[model samples]
Target: MPDRLAPLTEALLAAARKAGAEAADAMAIDGRSVSVDVRGGALEQADRSEGTEIGLRVLIGRRQACVSASDISARTMAEMAERAVAMAREAPEDATIGLAEPADLARAWDLALLDLADPAPEPGAAELQDDARRAEAAALAVSGISQCQAASASYSRQRVFIAATNGFAGGYSRTSRSTSAVAIAGEGLAMERDWAAESRTYQSDLPSAEEIGRLAGERAAERLGARKPKTGAYPVVFDERIASGLVGHLLAAINGSAIVRGSSWLRDAMGAQVLPRGLSIYENPHRPRISSSRPFDAEGLPTAPRDIVRDGTLKSWTLDLGTARKLGLKSTGSAARGASSPPAPSISNIALTQGDHSRAQLIEAMGTGLVVTSMIGAAINPTTGDYSRGASGFWVENGRISHPVNECTLAGNLRDMLMRITPANDARGHLSHVVPSLLVEGLTLAGA
Candidate 1:
């Protein structure tokens, strides 16, 4: 398609300069998506969308403003630039507002090696509907599954281009295929539901829709007849499915934006031990086929592998240009931006070191506690790291699962929880966040 998005970004930059912008950056994204959902073993919904979006950021001295639109006409481009320049003129000055210097821009990349876009033909809506219907049928086949809530299959392809006045220009495309299902067990007031989903860059890599549905059904069946456990201080094992959330909190604490605001628990933890002694967290943006992989950040900076936490110690803050400048540190090339916003720090393709033991082994090691499969809500104190969340899972006694439990609260200090975590070797490799199941000690569980 004659390089559709690049020309749009180039035209946007040209318009910005014509509109009296001292400097500017532009991004254009073109995307198409299709989804099919099935309910009661029949097609319930089918949707498709195709569009192009353009964004412009113009700077006047130290002030900057951003504008975005779905219209790609020349007239809209000019109007967007004019409005952006006018807004910049009225905006408050920020010393950190500026594009990367020419020398700092990514000079080259190997998109072929990344394999982000699958070469295979897109699946048709009819094919997707069949997949969803098969998933629903499989869920219903499970022994104790009362109903299949919904089953879906979807595909998306997006092309993105970024250009700046500082001579940085690049574009890349990505594709994803996904299948998901939700299953319910029991009925009425005693009902319980669970879900399973899988996504991949190449459709060939995705699991069969029937497999996902069966997993969902089995999990929901396992949750039947759940009740509350006794309140006490006990060890807790976070399942691999939800363990990434715990690591995400640590990532957020080290975000330069959070650090700059002095609102993070790890604000003063630089070079200090944050995770357990043998654990480390690594960010690698070049991982092939991973959804978060990118060769360059939003500001045109080249991305590379780095250790966010090494040997349990806090190593580096996630940062973009603005936050790095505010912190008096160098950018980690971790910037991400949407069509309507400016660049901000964000991590991609992070992995926590896995342990030698499996998830079942960790469960055995915990003796008596909870194996938290799912959680809801939170009351976290960001500054102090005090954490409380509603949780549901199976209760363990003498290192064996006794029964399912729900409507309970798990409370602990994140700082301490992370420090004592024991990782299990059960992380899925295809995921962007390769965090394994984690066992934490001395948490207060409130139940009936």
Candidate 2:
């Protein structure tokens, strides 16, 4: 920790070029965390947090601002670089802001093949309350659960750092580990809750605690006695533990700041044909132990591997570097930010592109419909790619499934529901999207 983010981004770019700013950028963070919670047999909460933060942005030509702190003295980084160079001298010019062009930054790569930090030794807090009391006693020893309510365990570490005045600077460090459980089932008002979690970056690829309390007591005893189905159009499926939220609504309708604010709906779909002609999605920021692997970006650029849907067209647009200079297009390094704003267009480690049936053969090739599996809220319109939400699970019929239903809703339109997806072949691959278990077909729902 004797780096202090390259001397707090070299004293926040010498206090934004001594406050008259012309260009600037800096970011810093150093974090730490630990959590543990459990219920019914001890410790219901425990937390620990550590800190260090700093941010600055400045600019002035093509105006810019942004400021942040956790007081990294030197008079709070010289009053956060003179209040971000007097708020970028009254901000508001924006010819797509600036920074990032020393031949598009990111000079040199490979952070040990991005295994992203996890050289062990961190756990504690009584080893996260004994991994949340052995994941709430393996979800109350299964058999129609009835309680395990909240069990958790966590750990974290950060360390970021960016820096720029166009010359760029870098930094990295990461670590994580988690475990969760929720369970619950029949009783008053006929209960029924469910949950299960896992996260890793080694903890030897976390997973136990009785495999997250027996998968949260077999998913709350498979939603004990639910019911609702019956209300118009059909075919749904979805569930590969929430099919990467339908490719996260086509990656927020191909964000490039929502296609330069025309409010995306695939913003007139670039190369058109969106999904289902052969699927595809790609992305990949250097995988290795994943967790949205990253090498540069956040304005230091260099994050390779692309294809935002190929074979099915609609490729690219998740830019960054001021939305690729406001759409004159290019910087698909897909920036990202924190420590308080600046740098947008996110997305990292995608995958999708796997299908050879098998989600019970797409539920016997959808001989009936709806399979969902938890979802709620979200209406979504984002410029008319419509879509609704709510949902629950189990209902198939002619091809298996059958019981458990609940609430309902569903609706459709995400460009004709991802042009009638299909996907399946399990997906997971250390997530950060990696979609699968899709199916689709018609939609509408509503219910009972």
Candidate 3:
């Protein structure tokens, strides 16, 4: 544990014991991040920040309460712990609230999640500016490219620690870098802008500046003149980037805390078929080269790979210790927490199984369809599986993207969408929710 976190953790535990609490936990996080935005091929904004926070939780005979602060001194911790215990004492007691049992804690796996060493010096401001400029410049250099909207680069690092009275203690750190560009092509009212982004755990993993720029340039150039498609139901294909939203929706629906509160649509659907027969989903905390991979959860519980959905059947609900006890189920080591909040259930790396059809093949099979590239607006009701979102993309005709389309809405029930899932073989590992292009029939598209 970091020297700054250890004493605070001990003080919190002692305070909880003195307050007649059964168990307690504390977590601390310190992080730094920088972002730079370029517009019109010039630097538009640059920002850098760093901060640390501490949180304390106490369980007083089944009633739990939490408090957090950015301060790390002994006096501050003692005050926070005192406040937490006082709040717990006055709160309504819940029989299902408690920490993981000693036996359960003993079963945790040992995994390394953090890289303790300092991150390498990121690309300097000049280098980052050059990278962004180079990307946009390349885009503009492409034939038919006319203008640019924005280009940017960002880097960030985080370190976190969790400690509990029941002998759970852990911490880890990681870094991230990203570069992106957006460019417009053509002129007059027919102009179109397209964008591309590349993110990586290490800077070295990022695609070359030329590659990212060329992709953006080509995408914009290809959409020089576009038109609306005939309004009607059609098979829809979601590119991998946009398709990841479905995975995010699944995570929200299977959250253990939501299940316990009757807020999740999947509350009673475990073990039932939730998707196509060949589809499966798993949460793998140990997967390499993924941003969300971790050795242990936010509550210091050892994490392991587990099937969230198997062969289209819902296998389990993600759980934290509190919710697990309430539901009479075991925790899946999915607990996550911010520095100032209690542990909540969340997925680490959600990996969807790929199928045997390439993106092009899937498009070819569709014959006439809409290929969604981006989504707008938040229009999902996780509690009921209802979803509708504004989308922009290209229209495919006879196995080819015929025109760019905008001002369209895609509406459907999530449950029904999952059941209609037909994946293509164009899976890419660019996002945390790695997924292949998805094809679904009969989606309602509201547009001309």
Candidate 4:
């Protein structure tokens, strides 16, 4: 715990109690971020910012109020508490809004095992600019590449402390570093764009800027002279990079808040077979080097691994304390929040089980279909599971990639599409959301 943040949180909690609140929790987050962008072989934009933010959440019987401020002075803390309590008195009552009980609070945990932050000194602006320049240069080196769109590098560090009137208190620090490059091919109406980026808790884990840039340039060049495929029902294979979106839908549907409100497509899907047999989606928050790993959540709850989808069946809903209480369930230790808002249920470090076939083998298995490499917009029905998206990718014919295709709409029902998924073995290992390329059979494709 940072010296300044912990004391600030304790003071806010004290102020809230003195202001006649029955219960309260306080949070303080101090963070610093730096970013540099390069374009056309010149420095384009640079930014560096740092600040401390504090929030107080007070409960007056069933009513709750949350107040936040960037100022951490003593006077601001008193005013925040006073205002929070006053607002709570006027707000509508909610039976489920309260802090976790003392028995359920995480008392002690080893954050070192999570390995969230890098101990290295912060990278200077010059170093970040150099990285951006290198990425841009590498992207422009690729054959058939028209030009590099933008290249950038960024770093951030944050320290968080949470304390409550109840006996819960904990803090941790995390750091992130990233590099990205976007490249374009062709010109005017025929142009296409693609990008590559990587982020890691430790800078050492990030792939080389040159490698990231080269991959972006190649992806863009591959889509040059894209033509639309014929309109028909065909299998669609989502590339590994974007395949996680499919799983993300399931995650959203199973969120405790959505389920409690009866607004999720998967509300009645518990214990139902949601995925192909032999596949499971696991949530392991303790994985090292990944950005989502955390020993304790924002609400001071110990996080542990669980099988969200077990043996292809929908097993659990992601839940925080409040949502879990509303759903008549226990917290899954997935609470996440910022200084400006209340806690919410969220997932961390997800890994879908991989299959034996490689991406190429899956493409071959697809036979005649679409390999959707990128998607633009989404139109999804949360209650009905209807999903449609504008997509662009390569067309497959006779078990081989024929040419790039664009101006297509891939439409399918989420529940039906995921039921027949064929996974490939090409999931990026270092990503927080680890899902393989998925081939869904019998989807409607509208093109041209």
Better model by TM-score, 1 or 3? Answer: 1
Residue pairs with colliding backbones in model 2 are none
Instruction: Give model 1 RMSD, 1 decimal.
Output: 0.8
Question: lDDT value for candidate 3?
Answer: 0.80
How accurate locally is residue 60 in candidate 1, as Cα lDDT from 0 to 100? 99
* Steric clash pairs (candidate 1): none
Cα lDDT, model 4, residue 110 = 82
Error of 4 at 406 (Å): 0.7
Please give, for residues 97-178, the per-residue lDDT of candidate 2 as tens digits.
8888798688888778888888889989988898889988988898988788899899898888788888888888888898
Put down candidate 3 lDDT per residue, 1-448, tens digits, no spaces.
4576566667767766776677898887888888888777788888888888888888888788988888777788778877888898899988977777655563454334433233578667777777888888878888998887888888887777677888877676777888898989988898888888998887877897778888899988877766666678888999887887876787788888788889877878988999889799977777665688877776666788889899999999989877888888888988887766778888888778898888888888899989998788978887898889988889998989888888788888888888998887776675667788899888888888
- Please give the RMSD to the true structure for each candidate, in Å: 0.8, 16.4, 2.5, 0.8
Clash number for every model?
0, 0, 1, 0
Candidate 4, 327-363: lDDT as tens digits? 8889999999888788999999999999999999999
State the lDDT at 354 in candidate 1. 96
lDDT, model 4, position 123 = 96
Query: What are the Cα lDDT values of the candidates?
Result: 0.94, 0.86, 0.80, 0.92
Whole-model alpha-carbon lDDT for candidate 4: 0.92
Poorest stretch of ten by lDDT in candidate 3 = 109-118
**What is the TM-score of each predicted model, taking all chains together?**
0.99, 0.38, 0.92, 0.99
